[model samples]
Target: MAKLSPKNLHCELVVTVDEKINPHIMRDRNTGQIYADDDYLYRLKLRSEKRVIECDGLRYLDHSLTVDEEGNQELVLRGSCPSGERTEVEVVHRFSIPVRGRYIEERITIVNCGKDRYYLEDMRFGFRRGLCPAYEPGQLADDISRFRLVAVPYRKVGISQDKGSPSPGARPSVKRQEYTMEDMIEGKFSNVDWRNDETVVGQDLVDRYRLRSEGWAWTDGRCGLLIVKYNDEMIEYSLVERNGYSRRECLVFGGAGFALYREPRPASVLEPQTKVSFGPTRYIFFDGGWKKAFYLFRDFMAEKGHGLPDGYNPPVNWNVLYDIGWYHSDREKLFKHYNLEALHREARKARDLGCELLYLDPGWEVCEGTTLWDEERLGRVEDLVRTLKEEFGLELGYRTIGRVYRDEFPNEWYIQRSKEKGQYIRPIGSDGKPIGFWEPCTECREWWEEKLRRILGITGEGVKFMMFDEFDWRGPCFNPSHGHPVPSTPEGHVRAVYRLIEEVRRRCPEVLV
Candidate 1:
């Protein structure tokens, strides 16, 4: 048995290697509580085989403690997967214990060593099994009923537009769910990927479990593990949950192991001598309950440059759409209520309410996705800024989006969802006509430049805030001329969006986006 107890962490980790190596023990040193033991660390399936193989089944080759690029000391375990008479794959599991941070970083690498190509069906990592549920009570641990899964949803939930507006005091709340062993088994740890489901792309609804990059926390009210993944690929892999067994149940974390069909859409293949990596999944351990865990996570993110600037106090914006009503793209109501006169009245209300800014929703755009300021209906952007500041003492801001209510671009600039024989010009519906609306591909260089230029034009006209909404990727584009891949990938799309934001900040440093 080899043990590692980092001085900064409150937990102890260990691995046992006699015949096979298993990095499989986590113990909270505070109360002498043991969380996992002799657990299977990873599970991966080969395309040709029906049997899912685990890390424990691999023959142990060697183990060592090495320093990684980030200067953290890591425990590295190497193993080889065997076929009938030969070694086919090499697996390496790494656990990095940060000397200054209260967390462990886990990553797995699978290198194809066989002569033939290998198509991976699935891959999952973490403490693969345990003697009992993590929430189960023992002399050294808290009761099972006291355990809770605390998640701060990545998007708005519990508030629905169709059901009518919530009261003025209503706000989005955190989801704190209590679960039994059965509930954990039923839900497992499957992640929700919005890009895979096209039907729900533009639909409005409530969802609490959207797999966000921010990550989630699981707690027993005394100690907890905060799992965060930095990957922003088009599809999301499951992380953190429990799996059930008749005689033994395991609390799984980091990688869920089950592969979703759409995440690696157009399934990827590992050619011979190729290396595929899963994650640099982080497990941040903390004492106390979920709130403390969240605060710690926030601090961790801040350290990673995701936090707001120091001493930057945000202003309270008064969105008039709540009072005037959400007309969406309805031209009739928009023309009647979204003009300057109506907005002036709303500006007065914002002034009266001590609001610092008057935020426009969807009606300020020439078209919903145009990002062009409707100077004809809303007056010039400069005038709106002047009146709001000089007359009502409020700053000016508006919403910018990705999907267009009307097709305002060349056919090639929009998303190409189909490459059928007759679908060359535009996306052909089942009925053989062009799709009604257009979703601009962020990865399209022309559209990307145009969108950035338009957004900068408005912000340059003294707009203090810009609310980026409705920019979710609907699907991939199949346009070869767009300067992206023939079928645009989620990673490319996300990077384009990030590049857009970065460029905006670079040009308009003072503007809050």
Candidate 2:
């Protein structure tokens, strides 16, 4: 029954809504424009207590809009709904189309607005405009198949289908994938939950760069929809079907919904007047293929201060760890294969061959992953770096395992200490009981801090680059002493990793992560 229309150099965004404050059409002025969409951009995906909350379904309320000095526009719509006469909740949805960047951001705040509490679950935010109403439901689904859906799952060693990194004008690492609607129906493509080593391939065995991809893209040939779950802890890229453009044909892509690591805890009370911020879910529409859209996203990220410094230059050198088969070691030969003199000689040879740096992968630490270096074998890391520079004029770097080596490192000491403090990763049971065996709980604040200190210590030894191998420690942790949720979630693990990485950057900003 109401609408809001805005125009800019990108395109004109016409937002139409009904009594429920749901946006029906977000038609772009020019379909062929770089940032234009072919149809009503998409509808929002939402749910509470298993009941779908559509824009037209709820009773419409009040709406308003505001524009800043920079020409950024934010539309706020407010409405209220009762849950079968029990809890009454108010919803305030804010859709912001920024003056800059290639994506439009969305955030929804749900408040009880009543004396009682409200619970929302499995809520995913996505877009779904009626897809070619001229076609039948079955036919629409068929049409969606023409536009392939690209799902990017997060992996430490992401098996990229691309050639190189996304440095400047280099060929972007775009992993083009097409998971069918059949895959969504059968639950084959799961992007939210973390997969273990059994399901994950080329993780601990091989070494590769991290893609940080947990998103999806739908593209035909010229234009498409891009919904990326960028750096949000509570969200995951999803493709589950919902009420949308078709009965069953309209496929949803690049949307985010709630993904639990384990059984979710009971919903806490939403006190009256308390506002909950749902998302800033990223949406980008662009001309050409999905690559062009993704590149726009990449550029947006750089504009947001994630890119390198103005004049920073990275040294792309060789790592003798994985190729030479020295990555995984139980110290069978000790340092005989890679001792101080051997590394010195190798550095001399490699330096002469124009290798900018010599990476002392393994066999440098006295114990596997231990900060202590062997005096007799590789000598001190500082001394080795000085020798690598002084003797061979080579740059210095280090690579270490994130986990303590079972065969070589002293695990008993760590285990006994953990046992004494009742702080091991117990993974099951709500009673905070041990689940038999254990892996060092990275979620433990102490353990995380220790790793931070360890990384900074090594970086202070003048390391140019540090490779954190086997870092994605996964599983449910029931140990309450670790100071994480009863069952550690994928999001919790990711947040912990991000925090630790941030801390390292804060302390040692010069060292390459």
| Model 1 spans with C-alpha error above 4 angstroms | 1-9, 46-56, 66-73, 84-89, 98-103, 112-118, 129-176, 185-219, 222-238, 244-247, 255-278, 284-286, 323-333, 421-436
TM-score of 2: 0.71
Candidates in order: C-alpha RMSD to true structure: 5.6, 8.0
Q: Can you write out model 1's per-residue Cα lDDT over 131-247, one digit (the tens) per residue?
A: 354455231223333455555334223424333456788765433233443455445323333332333233232122223334666667787767776544434443555555334
Note the Cα lDDT for every prediction shown: 0.66, 0.53
For candidate 1, what is the lDDT? Answer: 0.66
- TM-score per candidate: 0.77, 0.71
- Residue pairs in collision within model 1: 124-257
Residue 249 alpha-carbon offset, candidate 2, angstroms: 3.2
Per-residue lDDT of model 2, residues 150-266, tens digit only: 543322223444333556665434333455544444444533223353311212311011112445565676666566655433543333342333333333433334443311122
